[model samples]
Target chain A: MWRGFSMRVVSAFLIGLLFGLGLVVSQMINPAKVIGFLDIAGDWDPTLLVVMAAALATTFLGYRLVLKRGKPVLDASFRLPTNTVIDRPLLIGAGLFGVGWAMAGLCPGPAISAAAVGGPAPWIFVAAMACGMQGQRLIRP
Target chain B: MVEFTPLSGAVGGFVIGLAAVLFMAVNGRVAGISGILAGVLTPVRGDWAWRAAFMAGLFAAPLAFWLATSEKPQVVFDHPLWLVALGGVLVGFGARLGGGCTSGHGVCGMARLSRRSIAATATFMATAMISVFVLHHLAGF
Candidate 1:
């Protein structure tokens, strides 16, 4: 009863809420800001650097301490990724994502969060991202 | 070069990190946006509810912010619909193929000191930087 569906759902909701708020507060939803940072060849914003550094620092510190504990508060074990082999798929996939990210400055999280304000671009990006994911399902080996 | 708010950016990033930490601590999840949304696309048993809750929370964030601050979250997509759509496809597919994205590999994986995530993260940044350089400089996009 303690570690049930309700708790998981509620916690996820709250986490999503915080994530969305953080994205918004950080001005990360702004395409210009993202593109500016990515445009390393030209004038850069360096805003993402700060956000990324702070986020990385916090996550690294927290993970170090929390990982030393028993399993998750609710789950049986920590669900960490296992694959360590860096291969072509990983490089190409990340490259493709980066191209898309620079081209439109819309990644999964930002795209979803920006949909709250954007007229149609967010919707279009999300729909296409979802389709791309589906396409991967059909093509993955 | 346009908008640079380091204080807010750092604070927001820390909040995002906290969310990521809590997610792993309580739910034992990685908090990767691509994987999370991808799961919703191909719903597995015992996974949809929390995903739905998280997504709902994301959708609600902007509205909640507006209510609190009387300011809409700034959203700017300068790319045309077609380009944006294409970018989304690439990002979606690449995330699926790469096994992760910025949040998953860049933050979560790196926090755990996973070498693959490190390599993947480096590759994506290189490609993203190159992509932006080509689009802005060479291609005149």
Candidate 2:
């Protein structure tokens, strides 16, 4: 059991590292850059849309590739979401997230991705994100 | 110079999704940043190693980018700290309520085309627009 947990940790770390690396390579780690596109006050930064499109395409193709093989890279099977339909939680969460993104121009991936870049604001953003998660745990149900 | 093709974004996204899927297969966990960070607050003795390593990779990737480009990308945040804090809390709340952050659902889950993630990502995107509209347009803050 312990070994299994350890393996999982290793897997999670690699995934996260790749995720972070992607952010850097895509230049999403820089909020000024992100906001610059969103700014619309000057020359818009259309670069993010390009990055997002590329990411979407890759994931789309990846799913097609992986679905063919049942098992995953590690010990477990692919844990795809069982639900196929959209619901209220989905709507609410997206609305909230979009609001946050528009306000900050730094979504969770980049917020945490760019944490080490160091601005009191990003750290504060991360702190609230954690606290929000903790607050959820505190809520019953 | 190498052609400045937009394909790099797609390639980067593909890599991130593929990396995450691989990591999940091996690790048996969702690549949720909120959960990972939450794990750190009340951590188990041995658990710390992987979490720390994971976080280290997140921060270190930029250095790798710098090494490759020989240019440290400029990082900036134009928003005030208070708004940043507000936005962060909302993301945290949304993640907790929905049970995953953008990396977990938007990047990883959406890659697999999971409905939950799709829904979550959609909501996340929408809320971002609304938030921005409110801040820049309505609230005028």
True contacts kept of each: 0.81, 0.55
After superposition, which runs of candidate 1 have C-alpha atoms over 4 Å from their true positions?
A1-3
A40 Cα displacement, candidate 2 (Å)? 6.6
Clashing pairs in 1: none
Best by lDDT: 1
TM-score of structure candidate 1: 0.96
As a whole number from 0 to 100, the lDDT of residue A27 in candidate 2 is: 69
Q: For candidate 1, lDDT tens digit of each residue in B84-123? A: 8998899899999998888888888888888888888888
- Deviation in Å, model 1, residue A79 alpha carbon: 0.7
Evaluate model 2: give its lDDT. Answer: 0.66
lDDT of 2 by residue, B1-141 (tens): 012235655666666666665555555445666656666755877667666656666766666667878977445776788778877777777766675766777766777768788778777655654555566667775
Question: What is residue A88's positional error in candidate 2, in angstroms?
Answer: 2.9
